[model samples]
Target chain A: MPRFTAGDRVTVLDLGKPGHVRIPWFIRHKTGRIERYCGAYPNPEDLAFGRPGLPAIDLYRVHFPQTELWPDYPGPPGDTLEIEVYDHWLEPAEPLT
Target chain B: MTPEPIGYSADAVDPSRLVVEGHEGADYYALMTEAIHKILLEKQVLAPSDTDRVIAALEAPNVTWGARIVAQAWKDPSYKARLLADGSAAAREMGYAIKEAKLVVVENTSSLHNIIVCTLCSCYPRSLLGQPPWWYISKNYRARTVREPRAVLAEFGVAIPPPMEVRVHDSNADMRYLVLPKAPADAAERRFDDLVRIVTRNMMIGTELVEPYRDRG
Candidate 1:
């Protein structure tokens, strides 16, 4: 079962694992809504080291407001940024005030 | 030294002649790739015909593939819905069997525009759109697009109105994105081929809009 569904707010985990992680540093600890599930994919970290990549992880496309990502973002207030993140790196986010 | 003609000796002309730029670099990679290919061929890991097939696929032009799809989507709302729902599967309907990374199509509207970038690396929809443009893979584009998309887009000669929101998609993982720019006026009345001419690669990248074809002459 997937950890998150579409429209669910989530925050990317800031945990640093060695070697070949798909999670970018910029989106760590940032809150966003899951746009959609991108299906399960093999763990790239394990696959990079020649291990048999088993138990695929679910990936989700998370959409975040540009303001939430970069404080000084020059784009409009409604401008958004979307990124694909693996399930392990995301956790349920608290609701905004 | 052997006696040579003073006006134009073969060695002198050869030394003075301009050589191809990046020749050594190109040759180095070519040799390395050839060596790898030869070893794989010798071990029967890759058949000789495999290279031919890959070359053929690479050589297959992407001149009208994207345009045709965009035009079709404009003419048919149902097709547009499917394209927005499942971009990869929709592409497969057009005979492009995309088996690697998934594709997501974002539509541009009156108040919303979508642009694609891969900050970590250049992950593009190569199978359907062929190779990405050089500027799309540049470090400047990757870094700036996320920070200030409007400014970067302006450099590309695209100026988005303040009322419109520019959504920048950072393709950080396996999923690729394609911007579905809004169709030009009279798109429904235009012929498919005529509509195709209006869509450009830049438009699909969200750096520009689909302009109506015009004859300057």
Candidate 2:
């Protein structure tokens, strides 16, 4: 079972599938602050196979800036993106350089 | 930019044949099969296997259909009220079913704007609006839409004026959402289909709002 909570910083782990993974391509390898804790839900990987009992994973709503995720994101400087991610996909954000 | 080819299976009802608008997704075969099996088990159908090809054809994106509904609501006040009251019934009024999908309609008020996201996974309203966009399901949009919807909208070329509120609607559970954008000015007389043409999928998702074309050309 995955264990993470709101306010915890995490990095998305790349699963290597281009379109299949729930994590968006733009935010891979980046880190952000967790904004909310969406309770455990069915892991999508299990649902696609019509299987059941796959342990529910805790979901964290993470916030990141558009500029941080994209090199040429044409938006205001303060603009940011927040997404909900499963625990398995995230590791604690590495210390700031 | 060359648009991606529209994927459709043979034998599915032609989109034009249906009074409703929009194409379903290509992967609908699996879900349709499951639906048919349930129907057959209930003695509603004589030959479950007969629907094999139909199931395949049922696949198409649902955004176009969603756009149509938005346009219709914009043109008709009563319809709009019904939609805000009960989205599923309103969709059924237009001959669509919620079917294995939950429906939620987020109204955009003068001060507040609403956007939808599936943070954990891409649990979209596939039955009503078809497949979600590649970006919508992307971790970036999902993660950001909730916490920073205004910023996401800015990236999408939408800027909420100061003092305007931005409310992000997270569709994480069984309930899926559609944004009821504030109708643009001077759009009171446009036909439903024509109005739909102006309501892009991004607009339905709340990243953008429909605007009048400065020129037809």
Best by lDDT: 1
lDDT of 2 by residue, B166-215 (tens): 55555554456788888877569677677777877777788886652232
Q: Give each model's whole-structure lDDT.
A: 0.82, 0.68
Q: Give lDDT tens digits, candidate 2, residues A1-97.
A: 3465566677877765432345555556777778766567677666666777278777666776556765565444555555667787788885533
- Stretches of candidate 1 off by over 4 Å are A95-97, B1-32, B41-48, B211-217
| Model 1, span B48-111: residue lDDT tens | 8999999888757474788788888898999999999998888888777565598889999877
Return the clash pairs for model 1, or none: none
Runs off by more than 4 Å, candidate 2: A1-97, B1-58, B212-217
Error of 2 at B63 (Å): 2.6
